[model samples]
Target chain A: MRDGKDDAAPRARRRFLKLAGLGTAASGAALLAGSGAAKAAAPAATEAAKGYRVTDHVRRVYDLARF
Target chain B: MIAPEDQGRAYLYRLLARLLAAAPDAATLGLLRGLGGDGSPVGGDLQGLAGAAATAGPGALEREYHDLFIGVGRGELVPFGSWYLAGFLHEKPLAHLRRDLGTLGLGRTAGTKEPEDHVASLCEAMALLIEGKGDLGAQKAFFERHLEGWAPAFFADLERARAARFYAAVGRLGARLMTLERDGFAFVEGVAA
Candidate 1:
């Protein structure tokens, strides 16, 4: 009506395109945020790895078993 | 393919194998201490292991491991499949295990002098198998051929060994896990049949 066209096809196509574009942009933002969170979580995992290691105490036990 | 739920079983077997292999450090001890305890038998054993680690400390655990597994000449227990199956290490059982392991395309880790039949190593192999290297059929075959014959008895012996303290709890956990693995395998076989 605003464009002086009684047929609604062009207006509907415009709305559909706008919605699809918004959906894609929102998903892209979510993907970026997800990757950032994954990166932040990775170092904590490596820190947990440091908790278990071959220490002098373990070596001494290994030495005793040497026969 | 390994169902997603089966991964937990593989992880538990691996954990038990590692705990049995060496004394946990202070950090490792703390992680064990943090596990939630409940009324289940496995939970009780885990709590017992945690308590032992908290009370004894890493130094004491190291000494205990040395005494119980690495005595002057021989430890109080022999953690070997061959011994458990045939009254001696490197016997027919060990040979059979080696053949099966070869068929499975697994081998001992490099630089490790321990025999292939070591209980810890077998558990590790099963963990790998269940983690996707082998399917359910392969898992059942390996367990029946290698583990089911002797590991339960070995765990029972470990639970009763005079030198056991923290390891006794480990023994209990291992015993429970073995039972679960056995039952799981049987259930799968039953479904197939």
Candidate 2:
């Protein structure tokens, strides 16, 4: 049951996403290739293991939002 | 294994998180200017962003960002999930999100006063989930609990906000992506059911 549902569900979801332009050159991969934005936020698990540290990008956001 | 298509989703989420986190610097703007998209709605919004980035100047962009997100007291739009869902900052929604994040082995970086439910943080969290830190079930649960309720409305508001220029494009793209994710998840659920 798990294997069957996983196969059908992911395929259907992937098809839907593709139709909606996700992961396509128009929407995802090509557009993000040169941008450093993708690396701006460290994953929570990684950050947790390494100790809590916000990147400069995230720090800047905090600074901007400070009242 | 993470699929290439899922990588795109992570990339989109990270880009949105970055943009919402702060105004774009010169390098970011340059990247945005070079972005190309196909004819889909999401693609059209990307094109719109590229156009906006091409024409935007640093000074004006700074002012626009400030006006839209971080004015003297508060900006025109509050980008926190708590505010959107609970009519205030640091409300129950934030507490719930914090509890959820802890369960996922995630926590806010020390010394950051912003709540976990800030739009940027939520987007970043979603990116992490998609990037393989969390399973599909986790991603679905996170989106449904924290973002699905209010993020679409926030993005729609950002698109039409008076001070939005480049960010209007960001907003449009965000709105479209959220819709796609919501529908995509539903499709999966329907199949599973």
**lDDT per residue (tens digit) for residues B14-67 in model 2:** 778767776787877888888887886667788898899999987888788888
lDDT tens per residue, model 1, B13-59: 65666666667768677766655445544455556766766676888
Q: What is the DockQ of candidate 2?
A: 0.28
Clashes of each: 0, 2
Q: What stretches of model 1 exceed 4 Å from their correct place?
A: A1-67, B1-4, B190-193
Q: Candidates' TM-scores?
A: 0.70, 0.84
Candidate 2 local lDDT, A4-64, one digit each (tens): 4448777888877776677674444334432444444364333322222323333434554
Instruction: Give the range where candidate 1 chain B is weakest over 10 consecutive residues by summed lDDT.
Output: B184-193
What TM-score does prediction 2 earn? 0.84
